[model samples]
Target: MKSQPSLDTSPKVSDEIRKTTCYMCACRCGINVHMKEGQVAYIEGNRDHPVNQGVLCAKGSAGIMQVNAPSRLRAPLKRVGPRGSGQFKEISWDEALDMAVGLLRPVREENPEKLAFFTGRDQSQSFTSFWAQNFGTPNYAAHGGFCSVNMAAAGIYTMGGAFWEFGQPDWDHTKLFMLFGVAEDHDSNPIKMGIGKIKARGAKVIGVNPIRSGYNAVADDWIGITPGTDGLFILALVHELLKAGKIDLDYLAQYTNAPVLVDAETGLLLRDGDGKQLVVDRVTGALTAFDQKGVRPDLRGTHSDGALTHRSVFQHMIERYLDPEYAPEAVSEKTGISAGKIRAIAAELARVAFEEAFELDQPWTDFRGERHEKMVGRPVSFHSMRGISAHSNGFQTCRALHILQILLGTVEVPGGFRFKPPYPKPSEIHPKPHCKVTPGAPLDGPHLGFVHGPEDLALKDDGSPARIDKAFTWENPMSAHGLMHMVISNAHAGDPYKIDTLFMYMANMSWNSSMNTSGVIDMLTDTDDSGNYVIPNIIYSDAYSSEMVAYADLVLPDTTYLERHDCISLLDRPICEADAAADAIRWPVIEPDRDVRGFQSVLCDLGARLNLPGFVNEDGSQKYDDYADYIVNHIRKPGIGPLAGFRGNGNKAGRGDVNPDQLDRYIQNGGFFVEHIPAGANYYKPWNMDYQNWAVGMGLYDSPQPYLFQLYVEPMRKFQRAAEGHGDRQPPNHLRARIKLTLDPLPIWYPPFEDSHV
Candidate 1:
């Protein structure tokens, strides 16, 4: 949807070139902005950069228009007339900071829930989350909740790696690739680059989508399926593999919990007295340790530990999908794919997974003291994103795709789907959200984290939503990213609590960015009985005067991307590849001609004005001179900050003392730094001793213990148990059934809510 950069009529000339990161879109490609004696002449990609290496997208190349737009807000504006009237008067930064402090101080002192902080595609969540936590508010999130959190939650809970940014296919070595319902989005440049490499090497690519444009147009075989039926197709393929006995049993037993015993009565994994999960030994006909040195495990059988009858997790899984109803003929009508075609595709998958595997001549040792000279691989890979994630059944469908990959033994291996760096965070590693707020103190933890059970839910003692977004309630219990779309509607109706202010950054909540344009406009300007606005205050920051500028009660104008200092750190979505970890920053390439500030600088100023906990010194003096000073000095912990590279006394990367000249080092390194991960540590990362040691040493991962791929996630079972009224915290009666069905530990294939009745 981007228009191409126009051809300049005059011959392009350059006086000097400055390297920086691009922000026209979210890709954050590196660029060399050509300056012709004080103005930007042309911009091109930085070839040495890791992200877009010598190539820039249309949006990134069109940044000249963004900086020179005539409608850009040049100064702060305090609305002089009614809200949404497009009425404003320019003011100084001092008055703007005072206004913000006065409006937010009362909300922080009395009830922090009265303020909602959300942003649209905000890239600086590390600073924002800190700001919200220290400000004592539980309502804070970026835009992920309404975008693709379903894909992230499902993939992480299922396998400790996802199919998008957290992981990707080994595209260079893959013989066959399968893309499910993905369009021309999501890490766009990398995907396009990968596809180009695959096609050049004569690999076969298949796409499963309802639409056949964009990337699907290049697919060798495009199988059009009904929407929300991806799980059904995936399970039918699993059924075929089970019937033909074409599974990788050795791979499953070695890397997953396939041999772990599960009790039928309680629907939980059976463990010994020491709490180690037990597995049945085929040679001795007795229970043995899951990690027993020389025991061979039985993958398909029923065994009990005398207290109760039980079966292996693998046995229970096949029992669910091996039914006659899962055959291709049974699901043909629902998927709109004929039985013969479905069988052909399933047969192709089986052949590619088993018969067409490749091998590498690399030496490595697994965790069990076993030595292998070559790494075995299945030359098949997969990817899926927003198309599958924006549905009611998105989580389960994504889990099914992960299960399909695991069954083929294609996770984190050569020529298969691979985990990106900093992934394989312990499968159960997501932190719990801290919901409690206290006057004059920050919350106990971050506002957004994975909720382990009903106990972690951000609800009041009377079961009302504690935060305005209704994120971790029974309505959406597994929402790791707090829901942003529901914040406005929930606050307007006072569904849980009424709010005093809505502070947003880089979001256009008025036009195409939100739902029901007319209604949102009305809600922004609505008044209560006392002639006061229903939403008492509004604050927005944007570089340009988009449609959203007309609605803000206080307009804090922001400098353009080329005129700011920003960091894409490891804490959030930094550009890290499977082979190495990296992060970058954008220092001002040109001075701003307007009386504006970067949003981060403004947030820091607001923090100082309000005397928030971390923004001030012991003597009540400002801790940082500006955003750049904070980026260099602020420490999240003892030794970590924004950038992990070029830390200490100028000789180390990742986990070093904060150097006074950190930004200078980054600029000298061509606007970014990539840590060099050894070649042997790249593959089989969960069990790779070298990778684990390096990751933990770099502060990217917490522990050095080997991470087991979660073939069957157990946290889901706990929630289901709570729903069944057998745990310490039970769901309300209304959500009990919904929780019971969606919280199945195994990947399930059920129709999306609306499709069931249709």
Candidate 2:
């Protein structure tokens, strides 16, 4: 390899061609760093990376500021004064590690269950999760506890697993792409690329949100719906879909659980062998049963009792939900948006979807053969994040958006709603050498004993969420939120079972969270006679006393992206897409200025210190000593595990021939994916029966609609039936999920835990 000359030295010049993954947001864009000597002088997107394709978002463009921030902690710091004093003394890695161990080891030994590990939204995967597990702590919370868990929960309830990639809209074939509350100012490469292609092809784009976003400006139509009322507007869209009989009923029947009404006891499909069940498909739309067998088979035996059955995913929604009083003529009353505008928007969406279907030479999956499937008669796509999902009814809002996407028949298709990375198989980046979980493995954390196990969230002998881990298996898909009560109880409780220590990594709960901020801080600060709160030993990995760090007993500095060898998968393009023909390379862009290490490195070291078996190699030291070696073991070594023959290393884009030793070459080449195209006439049907699964231990009452953000569907349904049986009028939908405990059954938005008053 030849050394690339520095472009310029005028404060922004670089001679080093460093390739690394962007950590700006979940969109892990492949970033190319041009360094002059050792300083990063310029940054740009890797043109060859297929996912981004020479595009970078505003956040990605500002990567330099993140790495070179003046506030970045350079060395490990020991709190010289009281906790939260923000006064510290620089110390060696040995001292910092020892201080951390001394503080936490005791807490763990006393009550390992009380030691809570909170990880922020960074490079999380099996490797990231291993630390919490090896430590034997029962309470492991993450940013998702506040960020996107609800949406993830919705996906799990509907689909087997949730994916974060939020696949590109089929702009090439889409007639209309809906932008709901996604501000492209903070963007990902795939989204940017997809939008560009859509605009270039002259497809219509609709932006439905309170504020006009950058992406909204480029949309063919922009509708400013009031904040928190996204659910109403989306429901109106579904109402329109049903009113016009334009839904893809056939696709729903074949693919999703939409058409099957599940049994309250078994969580099995409500249907018999031929798909006729207590539930009925009301859409009377497209009826193409393309993959019905595969779709319904997965839904079997996921209820209170273990048995298989059929239920339409769609009909189930209608059975449980009541159409809001806001008609097209009166949507403004409920959503504070004009009814005329709503009708126009609805009409435009339908017209576009229908139009694109013919343009792409595809028929509407529905029987009417309307072009409602796609944007212009193709497929539709929508996304909801912080701004939309951070509301009191955030989870419900997300559920509404998901339902809207399905009604439009835009899910799991090109220009439709598709989940990639962290959900799909053959992940883009190979698992780290010591990585325990398989790539894209879906785990019911609270419901199941561990990841990759069968689900067991069904009722126990007492009719609550089963206490035994056996009830939670990989086979059953349940909500992670159902176990939230447990986390809250643990936080508030001390004796019998309690978390005594807390480890936070790059996480600022008070700064970003929406659940009662002060309460969480109190929990974080819980102490006993010795003045130690529940999290007496707060170990943080951050550069500054940013709220959470201000409370840390020990603060350890960490290597930023430029200074460390990190993996790029969850936020990058879909693994299947990465395995396409070209994949991006993984190499350190800049040498570490200090001894600060990445999270994995610190954990690997800590695991060894604990004398963990898998931490070391045959030579006795840490086997996967460094990240690069770990990458080699997973991506290059053949027959190691699921990642055997993994050929993604180095920098390249698009799918290419798999390389054995040239991991970098395989990475440089775009990754792999099943070359997907328009699968002719696939249909998904909705559940038609009135059914509910029991939610054991959950004081769930019947309501108009009740859905948890994470797993545990059968339990929820069971609660619904129980409520009806009690003649409780199912408690008002608003109050049904309201609980006065630390963990509310439903989401209630509040201010963050810690606030930066200054």
Candidate 3:
């Protein structure tokens, strides 16, 4: 009674704040997870972080539910029943490792191509791709091919940078914004924040998409055009701009291949006797090396050097797009926009881009050491996403959008589509894909890389594609991201070849991901005449019980977001802003009560089990204990590791030695590190020496040559030539003509499939 009367009351302690990145989706928003009594209390976007700036999207906000969902797989599971019955029994990690290695090792020894490893929504692509290559499988791809490869490939090949975070809109200065098919896209939060800025500044916002929601809802006007016809719509805009003589001549002359003369006969770049590209001098009308100094190029004219009859690419453009078909009146029925409205929008675009140009007072020097007192900008900016990229004509459609932007000089200017860090690499300067097949040994390089011509195709001695998915072949030469959507069907049909195992991560292949969900489910469970499963085995990793979980032969349960170590590295989709070159990491804020392991850690463990080349030390020991050890010590190159910050002996970032304290440095800095981009290095980076040096220093580019815009893509032309039986890597007879058509160097407009049939 006396003790009860004493009544000692204790107050609850304040919640501890643990900073990390939100991995709910691929946005990688910076978040601060508040810990109350050793439990997650709440999560908020980091106030000082550059990517989100204290704000988060719905996906980021819903991360707690995503992590703590009841359906999350908590332990390693091996199927005890038929494949799709979802029957499973928990097993130790050691047994799981042995099972995976037992299934995969023989395939690697006898035929590595028999193993196809694909990933989806995975942030650690470099890791997975590296593993796939070391495991000696030529079949590997991320989800980008069916998602937005058009956006990326088109931007990279045409303008030197593409949208999935490689470039961004200049929200601070853009006056007229024309967005196509970009309602809710890859850059969700940053786009939301950008839309807010553009709106607050009272700039004109025009949505060129069908739906009027999300970003479209905030638009001052929604064009509501028909889908898959944006290329035609953009061509109409170009037609009107050209008819009205609203062009950026100086920008074209200095920045693009518009002035680069092409062989009128061959449809190829005009080369001089010494093999350098030739350009016609505007003042002298004489042919000169395109790289010649003091050469003023005439962007719009035809000239003859008495031998080749060359014409400027600008003149070629006049012949291609200044047609009656691209006229608004001609495409109105297809685009669902009136002729008058299309012309009016085009005029507005021209006015904002050319007449209402933006200029900054910062003085800078170009790559050629030419000094400029002010920086010039086109105030019109454009961005598009899945709506334009998912079509069969998507590649050219993306090219049309880039052509429109380049014509307006809206690339890398004060108020234009400025490239993000590690971009503006010599246009489409991709290395060859690793296709050499061997037994029980890794390939020479990463499995997935760019294929410039037929030589890069994964072909057998008979010239048929060696990879099961048929990526980088004449069927889809520009499939920089392999066609992941075709894998399940192809494997089921054994169209290319049968595979021993189909290893996928995070993708929901059995459900909404399939165009025909029921068909995919059937394929997943399909059996052969021998009464054995056609696709012998399936291995999948998922944090939650997705539709794909039911079909897996082995399930590697992944840890929740708050209980894993992850890196949003510069090598694979850095979470950087337009103004900030940033990357982030996440360490366990709360220990997992369950037995789930992070996918990256599992990958490392599997790599160690298989003794894949890069995963072991010179002494044949496990090189990395786990993902965290790999992140801290696995050098991507001589001076670079996963985290770019806190690197080097001096801790000087961008170029650095692997600081053992790199992970600690990231944690101490509130979970992210961003170096302030200097004012001089922020814009006009295609040739800005300061920006180029910084970019190269950060290992974004191999060399600092001034990156010229490739309006005339030579690599595509090479593929076309190869299709015509003129090169080492030629397509099969049936696929040659088709390759030639799709690999057109210049952008062309064609009707969508339905329109063509109708």
Query: Cα lDDT of model 2 overall?
Result: 0.50
- Worst 10-residue lDDT window, candidate 1: 506-515
lDDT of 3 by residue, 637-740 (tens): 88877788988763677778878888888998988989767888888888888887878787777778675688878788888888887866667788777777
lDDT of 1 by residue, 1-758 (tens): 99999987887589888888888777788899999888888889999999888788888789887679998889999999897788899999999988988899999888887889888776789888888888988889887887888888888787776866688788768878899988877577778888889989888889999989878999999999999898888889888888888888888887777888887877777778886677788878788776666766677646854876788889878988898778999999999988888888878877887898888888777665566688888888898888887778888888888888888888888888988777877545667777898976787788887766678888888887788888888888888888888877777787888899999887787532346778777777888899888888999899888777888888899888888998988878787888889888998988889999998898888887778888989988888778889888999877888888889986767788899999999988888989977877788887777788888888886677575566677778878988888866667798899889988988887789977677
Separate clash counts for every candidate: 0, 152, 1
The candidate, 2 or 3, that scores higher on TM-score is 3
Question: Could you tell me the lDDT of residue 350 within candidate 2?
Answer: 68
Candidate 2 off by > 4 Å: 1-12, 106-110, 160-164, 261-268, 271-326, 359-379, 419-497, 512-534, 543-545, 570-586, 617-621, 634-715, 722-758
Error of 3 at 167 (Å): 1.0
Model 3 C-alpha lDDT versus the unseen true structure: 0.83
Which lDDT tens digits does candidate 2 get at residues 544-587? Answer: 44777766777788777777655543222233341121223345
lDDT, model 2, position 597: 75
TM-score of each: 0.95, 0.71, 0.95
User: What local lDDT score does residue 547 receive in model 3, on the 0 to 100 scale?
Assistant: 87
